[model samples]
Target chain A: MQVATFLAYLVAAVLFITGIRRLRKPGTARSGNTIAAFGMVIALVATFLVVEVDAAWVWLLIGVGILLGGVLGAASAQMVPMTAMPQMVAAFNGVGGGCIALVALSEFYQGAAETWVAVISGLLTVVIGSVSFAGSIVAFTKLQELAFTGSVVFPLQQVLNALIFVGILLLSANVLADGAIVEAVGAPFLSPLVSLYILFAASLVLGVLFVIPIGGADMPIVISLLNAFTGLAAAASGFVLGNYALLIGGTLVGASGTILTRLMSGALGRPLGKIIFAGITATATQKGDQQEDREVHDASPGEVGEYLSEEANKIVIVPGYGLAVAQAQGPMHDLMETLESRGKEVLFGIHPVAGRMPGHMNVLLTEAGVPYDKLYDLEDINPEFDDTDAAIIVGANDVVNPAANDPEQDTPISGMPILEVEKAKRVIFVKRSLSPGFAGVDNPLFYDTEKTMMLFSDAKQGLQEVVEAVKSA
Target chain B: MEQLLVQLAIFIIAAFLGFELISRVPNLLHTPLMSATNAIHGIVLVGAIIVFATADDTFTIVVGFIAIVLGAMNVIGGFWVTNRMLGMFRPPVKRVRKRKG
Candidate 1:
């Protein structure tokens, strides 16, 4: 039995590693997911075999849980739109954290409490799991558009949080000391119930306070950070349960989440702290500054196509959620291929938080078989916009909006990070209509005159037509 | 050995089915699922505490107490945090004012 359990654990660990590796590449993500699921199956089987539960009622409870959870999980995936995927990821992480925490609690209850080690492990699980659960829920709500995703600062919010955290530590010492005193004095220890409740409350409040200051624009970073928190909680729970497989899995998740957070922060040209605490939007506004009016350019789709074929030195494609909604990746890839064949320098400008999730644009582009190297994050490609002959904005709105820098816009999205597409010599926007973005703000870039063209149609169909036109040319 | 293998298989299969089913739900249902699970954890905590307070065996009693506390923390902490986070996602309502010339 032990040998089989070890073998299963080994297999599961290998699968997890492979799945994580495959997750880095967009083409293999689905396969990676399947592999991870398979690993989880092995782990679950091993766990059931090793854990002793004598009660028949326990088995019945487990059966009920499985049935209930299964139904709920299936319903979520089918109903959630791609636009709300980030929130979904956050919610899933919370579930994972909650599961591990429960497992730890079960283990603690089944073990001898005399061991200081077990008590410490239980405490660790409570702290980390509580934080992860609360933090992830906050992240999910923000991503779901159900609540404000921006920074909310009450005076001394950080200071108050720190004080509360200190209070939790003090309470923890009392609990631990009481346990020791009971053993030393041959008396019953005070119930840890009060301390547990207090600790849990403090951690929960801290999680919300920690995430509330993070703005919507930095959701990718927040999501990554919360993922790391979940991983840490899982690892702590694994320790409490003395589960090797759990430890390995949790460590991997924690490490990956941290690395992803750092990479995202770097991509946004900001530190992790700033990403977490900076309430500034992608575009920053200055006080007492008048909105500058610039000459605006407008052109028909055909004329823009002609300009691309005739005079553009280089072209950069900016894709957004609209591209995903319209299923335009295939057509866009074909258009890029045509442009490259014409000896045009074509690159893609990918914003960090473009679309609903981090790397969403990159995932779509990679699915279309666009070379990984050609995809440039905002910081990497911002400088190139100046020398580029034409910037093709496709289905993207807030990221490419010039109003991010326009001081007088008074829009909620003003002072947020946005691609400086206007800096490009010629700008062409492809859209079905002049609809506002998710934030419901009009983009002044639509009216930019230096060299602007509006190609009206669904992104997929428009790109297909452009591909054909370029092919014929 | 065969019985153990069978049990393991059953557990794995059930877990897989459960995960697959849960993953398919809509966004709105996630919180409700979490809330329900939290309630279960609370029940588990209460059961553990009762066992600990009444059990004759010292080791079992100690273990039960630990489990109870940890389970309680999970239940209370999870729900409290989720609610606070949900608060952040609420959209601001605009107030309309009458024009006074």
Candidate 2:
């Protein structure tokens, strides 16, 4: 039975790897998700078979837990709109982190830390798991705009976090020292178990501190980083229990999540270290206030639509988080169709970090029944803007901000790769105000009257009006 | 010690295999890939069960039970949402299957 159980775990790990392998392509990604879920089922059944439950009440508890969790999980997964997928992922990831932390705490309760390996790994799990849990909850709230959507910072913020880290290390060291000398002394000043509880609490606080300073616009990288932390915590718990399935599955997520974090930060044109440490504080640079008073060309949606319908032959649409906030994807799709019917070439230029997460805009656009090929990636569409007649930007600012290219200006988004929309013959911005983006950097493109126009309105309403004007024209 | 050595070996190899598996996912599938891997790590459910079954005291039992519930939610919700997100990415042709043969 032991051998059979281990074999089942190995088979489940193989299936998980195969599923991720299949996830590399769009055609097979859905089946890949199904395959991974199947692996989870196998591992789950094998776990139930091997665990020796002597009490009938424990069985009832287990059954009820699974049933309740399944119903809630399935309900939310089905009901959550695609626009809210980032927060949904964060919520689920938080639960997983919390679950792992509890597992570590329970292991300590069972006195499984007799050996040195067990003591270290168990403590590691408690720290990382608790941090991941608390951090993920904070991330979810930020993305959901529940309490505080902007970055929170004060003087000596990083110093306070550093002091807390040192304190946790000192406490953990005492725990390890207590474990080492307990058999000899018979009683120690501080019980290792008590130290662990303190460590867990401190780690949770550290997690909140770690995420609260990161701005909401940087939530994608933060989410990916927290996801990786949870994976590592799970692997550490696997070490505590000597479980093969947990080790393999956790390591897979840990590695992939780390790589994904790097990729996301790279796409946003920021180094991973800078993003984690400095964060985008949105300090409201001096350029923002002065730009408001500058002369600008603001056009009505009808005039802009007439330009697209009559003057422009090839057009590109750039989308941002504002599009998601205004729920404008549907209306935007109507505008796309209208432009296409006019014998104009219309393609979507999707910056990798355009929305709240990587590929976020792509998912929203695809959900609105836009053809897959109609969307082009950043690298694929950057050069095409030069020959394009007009670029229609909907609620996107920083991603297309010309400041990223100006070597003279030292803005928060300086040196970040932008869409180069100013290269197009004409640029029209549909936005609520001349305000800067989440990064708090003013856009020179909005002020270029010779080729740029602003249609001031909500994203959905502006798109609707533009569609009507284009149709009538 | 030998068992620990074996587990460590498995961990390193799995880490390498993971990096290789998702090294080059296209931007189109990044969200689904993150969601899928998120579900895979929900394998912590197995660990939760192991702890719960062996727990003797009330504190341990309560902690273990909550862990089980959270793990189950993570597993179910992660995979279900990934599937839904991936379902939105259809090919260029619209409703091709609706035509009669």
Which has the greatest TM-score?
A: 2
Give TM per candidate. Answer: 0.67, 0.95
Q: What docking tier does model 1 reach?
A: incorrect
Q: What is the lDDT of residue A132 in candidate 2?
A: 84
Q: What share of the reference contacts is kept in model 2?
A: 0.80
Deviation of model 2 at A438, angstroms: 1.3
Q: Give the lDDT of residue A454 in candidate 1.
A: 75
- lDDT string for model 2 (A1-473, tens) is 38888999999998999899889898888898999999999999989889998999988998898888878888999999898999899888889999999999888878887778887888888898888899889989998889657878777777788888987887777778874543444555667788788889999999998888887877888888888888888888888899999999999999888998887888888877876875334343455445547878989988998999999999999999889889999999999988988888998999887888888898999998887778898899999998999999999999999888899988878878888898999999999998888878888888789999999999999999999999999
Candidate 2 versus truth, CA RMSD in Å, comes to 2.7
Compared with the true structure, model 1 gives a TM-score of 0.67
Q: What's the lDDT for all of these models?
A: 0.60, 0.87
Real contacts recovered, all predictions:
0.01, 0.80
Q: Which residue ranges in model 1 land beyond 4 Å of their true spot?
A: A1-3, A26-30, A105-113, A179-190, A278-293, A309-314, A321-347, A364-388, A395-425, A430-448, A452-473, B1-101
Q: List chain A TM-scores, every candidate, in order.
A: 0.77, 0.95
